[model samples]
Target: MARITMKFGGTSVGSPEAIAQVADIVKHTVDERHEVLVVCSAMSGVTNLLTEGALTAAAGNPTRYQAIATHLREKHSNAIRQLLPSDVERISIRDEVDSLIDEFETLCYGIYVLREASHRVMDKVTSLGERMAMPIISAALRHNGVSSTTISASYLIVTDDQFQNAGVLFDDTERRIRRELVPVLAQRIVPVVTGFLGATRDGVITTLGRGGSDYSAAILGAYVDSDEVWIWTDVDGVMTTDPRVAPDAQVLPVLSYGEVAEMAYFGAKVLHPKTVQPLVDRNIPIRVKNTFNPSFDGTLLTHEEHVTPSTVKAVTAIRDVSMITVAGRGMVGVPGIAARTFAAVAKQNANVLMISQSSSEQSICFIVPEEKSASVVESVQDELAHEYGRQDIQRTWADDDVEIVTVVGAGMRATPGVAARVFGALKEASVNVLAIAHGASDYSLSIVVRAADTERAVQSIHRLVVLNGISPNVHAPEPIKNAVS
Candidate 1:
């Protein structure tokens, strides 16, 4: 029997009803004779409440934070009362929930007094969500006649003290899981741990960033060397495009690691970017399943065992981006010009998304999220205005809504004309292609398109590259004139 690790997201265990649904899924897995380990996120919207509490406390009042904490405590206790049968189980679950709330209040009090929320303290506060949710889930599973134990992830998943975005120490984490967690699995008992929160060497709470629950599952799956890691989420699986944006978007049955990585980086909402690394390193396949539809065969992500399909595997895009241009004749052969421009952006904490440099070294262009566009432009102007002069180093910021559309497929590398086919389809659809970028891997082709045409662009690319077997050399019609300007 294959030993597997299954993780359910917040929506999967949002309430007593949802918890029962998850318990049913677990029962099926256990009945199949596979040793199972399950990890669960907080109830739907619980983490957000905890975050709001911290923000309120940091803004100078602890009253609202304390009230929110109490509300959260009541929410979990209510779930336990509805789900657990034995009085002992109910008390044990309540006490664990209370301890988590106590920790949260302690952190809020610190934030109120200091009038600040450091990443370390934020991690601690955010962790309470999972800590409060997992015990209720474990108790529910036990009441359902499945032997389950609540294991604290902070005790097993050890990382360096990087606070909000702590990096995992794999050797230490793997050792702890093998030595400490394996014993429980050996007894055929399911270990239900809280996802998204880990601890530093000194036992201080640290998080793995916003979508850390996905990362938590990947880490545990790798440590145990499980046969497969199943990520239970709200979506059906990884789709060819965002269903909301492109109604024609279809779900892909299989994907390679490279394809999945590209889709995640370019804004596929199925899984976090970091969640695939451990699976890739350990050669474990990952399945993205829907919590609501447990019977469907969801998408499977595996290493390249065979060539990717010739058609485009998926289309991904993200909106609300601003493109910045740094161009000047003086930039030609100017050493440290690129370095200075990037350093300036970094100083303002603006994330550089896509960067393209001209072969002549005369211009460097990058895209940043719309919110940081102004700050980034000012930082660049201040840093480069003197060296190349205002005119010499021309700076222009385009507020024209832009969307990044990427076509992902491992088959593109072997197929000649994949890029030509994608561009050809977009051209046929009259979708204006701005800057285009492709790497040596040939797994993806990214293009800048107008936000208005984002959905059409993805649908067109999906049809041309994925559904219809069109050749890259297929001739595309002439470009459409810009009427919006």
Candidate 2:
């Protein structure tokens, strides 16, 4: 029998109908003689509501949290009623759900009384969404005639004390899974596990960050030594680019681990940033499928990606980003400026997206989320205050009206002239490139451009590299007349 771990995002089980559909998927997997371990996120929007409640209570408005609690209670109550078949199951599930809700409410009340919500308390509060979801999903599976038990990942997956974004402790987690969960799976019982949550060794609640549900699934799949891990989300599979930005974007049938990693780093919505590491370590293939369209095989990711005729597999963009440039003629051979510049950014916890430096070492530039740019600039200026006063450092400034566009394909590593073709496409489309960075692996290249030119740039790149392949001795069609203007 095949041992497989299947994970569903919130949208997959957003409502009664959706939960019913998920139960059907589980039933079908079991009937095929596969050992299925399920991981699920909270119902759609539930976690946000829980987070808002915690923040509101922390803002000295505990009464507002009560209204949120009531709404959440009603939401889960309705889901349980729609999913469970008999009154016996309904009553049992209701009691468990209500108890968990009470725990959530109590946490909010504590935050209100203290007028503060630490990351630790927020972790405990936010985790209640997944805790509340597992019971309904487990009961739904049983109603479908599948013997399933709701298992708390907090008991199986062990992590460090990082409350809001904990890192999984692999050795301890693997050992705990073997001791606590293997026996249950061996009994032919499916374990419906909560996703996005784990606990410290001392049993303090913690999360793996947003979209950690996928990370949870990857972890469990590796622990079980499963043959494959499938992530069921709303989209059919990983797309060449976000369709919203490029209408011509197409779904990639397969990808390499590296290719998807680049996409994830540049803000692809398909997988969590940390989701692929565990499975990659175990050499397990991950399949991205759509719960809404189960008939499609979706996309598969493995070490050896499918070799496409095209050198570029996908073009994706990250919007609402700012580019920060640090330039100084006097610091051309500076030893500590780069280190000091990044140190300031690190203090703000800002993520650097794409980085480019002048060969002369006279200037350095990188992209970060627009929201964090102001703080990042302030910190850098403070760090280099003396240099600025002496005019040794020319300027450190941020441009908030920019985006990062990346083109990814494992084929690009082995192909020649891929970068030429990418730039040619952009040039033809009249999209001004502010900066460019080619990854060391050669699997991907990124360009920073004005936000207004993003869609045009992505569409043009997709049409040239993806659709036409830009074969040797052939060039993409000439740029549309003033298309980017």
Candidate 3:
């Protein structure tokens, strides 16, 4: 039997009924005699609650955190009552969970006094979700007649000092995982590990950022050299596009490491973008399966991506984005303008998503999350204060009304006219393309369009390129009378 690392997402363990399903799945897997390490996400929405508590307390509101503490108590205690049958077990676990929440209140009090939440403190606050999740999952596993124990991932994975988004030290992390978790496996006890969390060498706890539970599973699976990392989530698998957008969107049975990475980066659900690199480096496989529909084969991610004749695998979108552009004749052939412009955005800690530059070197345009657009514009202006004073950069503006749609496939690299087909579809739909970026990797083609046109643009692209079912309501359109360059 192969060693398997199974990760259950938040929705899979969101409540008593969900935890029961997870327990049943684990018992069946262990009954088959495979060495198993289970990774668990915080029960759905707990991390958000923890984050809200921290921010509200920093805004000087104790009443909010106190009420939040009580609400948490109700949610978990109600869960304990339903999951653990024996009275003694229920009392024991309830006390432990309450103590964890009490510590949450204490941490919030500290933040309230200081009126500031540092990244370190925010990580600490957010990590409580996973901390509270592990032991309860351990209890639920035992309730299902499986031998299981909770292990903190921080003890197993070591990373650099970056608090909110720490980078793992792979060599050291590998050594630690081997030293600590192997013996537990030898004992035939399933180790249910916390996801979305890690620590520095100094033992200060850190988080791997949002959706990091997937990354945690990837790291552990690679270090332990498991046969595959199974991500159990809500959906059947990765779809042609989000089902809400095009109800006809079908599940893709297979994808390549490169293809899935692009989809995740461009906002597909069920996998994190950072989760792909570690598995790709080791040639390990990732399988996305539905927790509700356990029998479906789901999507398999490996090195060899499938390419249809259409040369388009999927169309996906990232919304709530803005484009910032800097333009001037004086910027032509300029040396450091681009570098200085982005260095300023970096100082603001803004994430730049896509970038385009004219061949004339006269303008630089990029995308950022819409919420960060105002501050990013301010910072870039400040960075170019001298250029503004002298008029070298004649115009700088942010348009916070855009969304990015990306078409993904490995087949695109060898196929000609793919770009023409994509633009041709969008033109037929009358969706204006604000900016365009073709990824250096050749796996994706991204374009920015007005936010209002997002769903229509995605639908239009999905209809033209995807091979299976023809989307309804897709039609040939009148030719464009005028075009903008």
Candidate 4:
């Protein structure tokens, strides 16, 4: 029997019907004699509501948080009543749900008292979503006659104390996971664990950043040495591009870990680089499936490359980002201009999504989220003020209206003329290239263009992936519109 870790996303377990489907899938897997471990995200929209409730409380609206708590109470209680038919079971589950909601109300009240929402407080508030979900899902599985138990990831995942974005302490985390999960699986019981949260050495709750449930799954799958990981989400699979931008965009049936890693790193939201890093290291395969469409094998990501003639697999745009440039004649041959510039941005807690420097070393350019652009510029300006006086740094500025359109494919490493085709497409579309960056791995080509040109630019590069690659996609994936539920 294959040991599999199935991770259900928020929408997959969002409603009573959704949780019922999740229970059926687990039962099927267990009936097939496979040792299954299920990881689940919070019900859809619950985390967002929790976040809003916290912010509203901090804004001095205790009533809004109370309203949020009530909404949550109704939501979870309704799911329990619908999923568990026995009156005794339903009442017992509602009490558990109410207790969790009471804890949420208390924490939000604490935030109202403080009048400020700190990262630590935010993590705690957001974590309750998953904590509330596990018990309900486990109860559903039991109702289906599948032996199952609920587990909080805080007991299984060991991480650092970085409140909102804790990094996993892999060695300790692996030890805890096997110690906790193995015995349950040995007893032929499925262990339903909470996703997206962990605890520090001191036992303080911490969350892996937003959309970290996938990362949590990858880590657990790797640590337990599972045969495969199935990421069950709402989408059919990884699409060629955001179909909203390109009408012809199709779901990719197969992708290499390297290709998806580049896509995630460059800005495709379906998966993030950290989510796949562990799977890549362990050479484990991941199947991105639709909980709604279990019959279709959404997308199989493996270590071995797909032998296709496509030079570029996918085109993505990191939208709503701004670019900053530091340039001066005196900055040429300056040893610390690049180093010092980044250090200053890092001090502001700004993430540099892309970096490109002039060959002459006279200028350095990087991309940061638009929201953090102003603060980054102000911080860099202050830190490099002395250089400005010396005329070594004549200008340090940011371009607010830019987007990074990146085309990724491992095939580009061996294929010649791919770069020419990319720029040629942009030129053909009459889109101006503001700047460009290509990694040493030769997996992706990124170009900066005006925000107004984002749609046109994304369409252009995506057309290239189609002309170069889609013809040979032997394992066809379903269209997003008709994909399962």
Candidate 2 ranges with C-alpha deviation above 4 Å: 470-485
Query: lDDT per residue, candidate 4, 255-315, as tens digits?
Result: 8888888888777867787898888898888889888877777888888766456678789
**What TM-score does each of the candidates earn?**
0.91, 0.94, 0.92, 0.94
Which scores greater on TM-score, model 3 or model 4?
A: 4
What is the model-wide C-alpha lDDT for candidate 1?
Answer: 0.81
lDDT score of residue 309 within candidate 3: 66
Model 1, C-alpha of 201: deviation from truth (Å): 1.1
> How many Å off is the CA of 422 in candidate 2?
1.1
lDDT against the true structure, per candidate, is 0.81, 0.86, 0.85, 0.86
Sort all candidates by TM-score, best to worst: 4, 2, 3, 1
How would you encode candidate 1's per-residue C-alpha lDDT over 358-462 as one tens digit per residue?
A: 898877878888889888888888888786554666655655478788887776767788888888889878999777777575577788888898888888887
lDDT of 2: 0.86
Q: Which stretches of candidate 4 lie over 4 Å from their true place?
A: 471-485
Ranking by lDDT: 4, 2, 3, 1
**For model 4, how many clashes?**
0
What's the TM for model 2? 0.94
Error in Å for residue 103 of model 4: 0.3
